[model samples]
Target chain A: MTPDPAAASAPGVLVTGAAEEEVLAAVVVALRRLCAGGAELHLRAPPVLDASVADRAGYSTSFPHLLGAVSRGGAATDLVLTPAACYHVYPLFEGRVLAAPAEVSVLADCHRQEATTERGRLRSFRMFETVRLGGAEDCLAWRDDRLDRLGHWMEALGLPAERRPANDPFWGRPGRLLASAQRADRLKWELSADVADGVRQAVVSVNHHKEHFGAAFGIRTADGEPAHTACLGVGLERLLLALHHAHGPTQERWPTHVRDALGLTRSCTN
Target chain B: MTPDPAAASAPGVLVTGAAEEEVLAAVVVALRRLCAGGAELHLRAPPVLDASVADRAGYSTSFPHLLGAVSRGGAATDLVLTPAACYHVYPLFEGRVLAAPAEVSVLADCHRQEATTERGRLRSFRMFETVRLGGAEDCLAWRDDRLDRLGHWMEALGLPAERRPANDPFWGRPGRLLASAQRADRLKWELSADVADGVRQAVVSVNHHKEHFGAAFGIRTADGEPAHTACLGVGLERLLLALHHAHGPTQERWPTHVRDALGLTRSCTN
Candidate 1:
């Protein structure tokens, strides 16, 4: 997502802007550094996905009420607004077996029909995601490493957020059990920061799918066994909000290291 | 709209990425330079719009078949996916008289349910828009200046494009007449680029709305007269596509000025 340049220097309400660009650019640089040229970075994707694909991916079961349908010709088509970035990526590698760990970094526009109009909790938001697919041990290692990388990096930027137990927004009743299982297995962790509203917001998450996507999409390892997968997702807008709250409204007030990385010098947010 | 970084350097159908970032950044720089510290820059906006707002803005009538509705609890809410960046802006100043020429730049994700799977077109796309609201003369000058500025800058970057009389996508049969009127009156001008498909696609558009928005939204100019407005919208995806088609695949092959402007030095696309 391109940050709004006009609001770049100010703590104005516009989510991502030029002032936040340096931060986002630094994150991208970090992702690239982590990739070390070993992972493929992907930014190209459509906003909507095939309904059958989302259904098969368990979106309907997980977020049935949240699904945003794309109507075509006065009727709902087979297409659906993408609920999560990873949902689209897994289907792309359906029926494929990886000889080695394959990694990708992608930015996706995630859409959801929410009942709440809470600040920083938007129906449509951007997600910067890094995904790894391979054997279980390797995937777990990558996920854990990401937890460290993200936590440390946030602290370094002075937006010290904590990685805490997290849960997915699954559907009506059974979702309660699935969510419990998720937290029990420690499948998810959130990087949370206190915003101006005095509420801690989860701006980033690390998730280990443990062959969930692999089994559904038939993505296999070299041994022809279901692969394991892990994903790190950064809610870009929320992160920008947290940063604005932490670093005042102007980019000039940010640390020189942060500005140096983003290569941003002009300070008009005054 | 951010491009997948994997496909960023290479034009492999992903809309936004590292390459797009450089161009988008350059655009932001240009907007700031043009604003010259007087214009108020805005970056925060949600991806969706209220249905009633869209209705008052004439979207429900013009793009009746194209509205993307958000259904919750088995009923359609007042929310509709935004169709254009400017639609939401006009209502913000409804019934308010500007003290002077008010200028603003905004980036919005526009959603359109297109039937074509054509290249360079999608269901949802990003739009970077610069708008001016003032008296008729000032508004026209601002719009014309935008034409000159945009044309000169694109040429400076070596992405030479032509400006052609254009028309909006009005609704059904009667829309043909309305579109013809729009073109006849020179209400819109398009910046077109010749892509790999041997077809010219409009990457940007300059529009002059002489009190249409003001009258509809009750926006007023100084002295309490209906305000005249103009908008310059750059379709970031289409522009990026044009850049790829013009400069060829890899960033390394790009001109030195273009590369320098974007601060792009990496060349893994080889």
Candidate 2:
């Protein structure tokens, strides 16, 4: 990713004010427009999920370092903070056989405990994702299509983001081999952008999960085969910071097309 | 709170689907219109909050039973899932003097470890709140005004909810004293509605905090007096359940005005 000096001073995480809300609203609208294929949209989902569901999703085994467990009054509970928005989607389709491909779009506040407090690497952040479930070839093709569409969307917003092959930050010794295999198969591709001064980060990730979640959740296709899944996930806060970097901190001064794309027109009246 | 037989079988905690998304979006639009007064709107807030902030807010002492603590890999962390939406707003104004009263509205997913698994008393739920910070008199009057307006809104939606004096389920002996004091001061009023079969719940809470949060967060008015705070909070899923009870389960068969109010017209296209 190309370095941009303007994003060097971009505010990391926006937790207050109307501008942040406006930007998020705009992002939702844009995502809906981009994923307009009879998609089921969910505006909110619980931050915590059932531990059994997490275990079935292989979250702890794959990335144990990132899991956040929830307890009541210092006593352990059967819940963990959601690591990804798509995890919630998989449970909804569990034990069902899809007649055709299923499309789901959700915006959820996801949590992961990161070892580093670096910019754009927030422990708590919002994720806007469009998930597709179908055959393996269909899922991979959908992932590629989303990558191109998301890349164009970034360009439209005046941000220079590069799409590159990537892998999950898996845990333990076995995780190293898993990460290498994932890269060899090119299961993940990230749209990297300069969110801060010389700080390049992945703002969007498109991943293809080949029969992993479906096999775990007992979801199947009409052909008696485990369904494949793919997700195009956008990190909302990181995207906002990238916008701030490319368009400057002030919304009023940003290009008209960019503002229109993000629906950032300042309303005089509430 | 009047009983409604239709709501007896209403589903609780809708985590997925297009209808759930539509209802939430409608609730947000209605809230924005109701809270139209140059309010700062936040669509999201982290489910977990800093332990120190929760302590300063007196949440642990007041409602210890409802708090959910966060841990990473069995090790405790200094974080707790937010119990209410208003707690996040107070810390934003810490040690600051407001020139005028500040109005903020937020929609956040709140977690409260309720002892019961009854309908409408969810462990995890969405809260849409409009908060006000100003002088004591202003806060009290705002609370009353909100109570009246929200009552009308409920009536317009064809729901038979009663506005009654209430108190938080404070914990222990000291909490008992605080609850009694709050009740004596008439600081809290709830719009109680029958969300299910014989399940009377507080669908909305209008609270007047006379310098409590202000003192805790060190927020002051221009005249140097600690600011008073008030919040009008609506439980989204409970309200939806109440609506279902009042109008039946089928959205297509509901009254046109009610459908219009909720923006629940089933779109033919995505």
Q: Which candidate number maximizes TM-score?
A: 2
Candidate 1 lDDT over residue span A13-118, tens digit each: 2334444655665556665665324555455455566678787878877888888876643467656767877766676577888878888776667777776645
Candidate 1 residue B118 Cα shift, in angstroms, is 2.6
Q: Grade the docking of candidate 1.
A: acceptable
lDDT of 1 at B189: 89
DockQ of 2: 0.31
iRMSD, model 2, in Å:
9.3
Instruction: Show model 1 residue runs off by greater than 4 Å.
Output: A1-17, A20-38, A44-46, A72-74, A254-270, B1-17, B20-24, B27-38, B42-44, B157-160, B257-270
Q: What is the DockQ of each candidate?
A: 0.31, 0.31
Tens-place lDDT per residue, model 2, B154-263, is 88888878888899999999888988999998999999888888988999899998899999989899999999999999998899889888888766787988777665
* Native-referenced TM-scores of chain A, all candidate models: 0.87, 0.92
lDDT of 2 at A120: 84
Model 1 / residue A189 / CA error / Å: 1.8
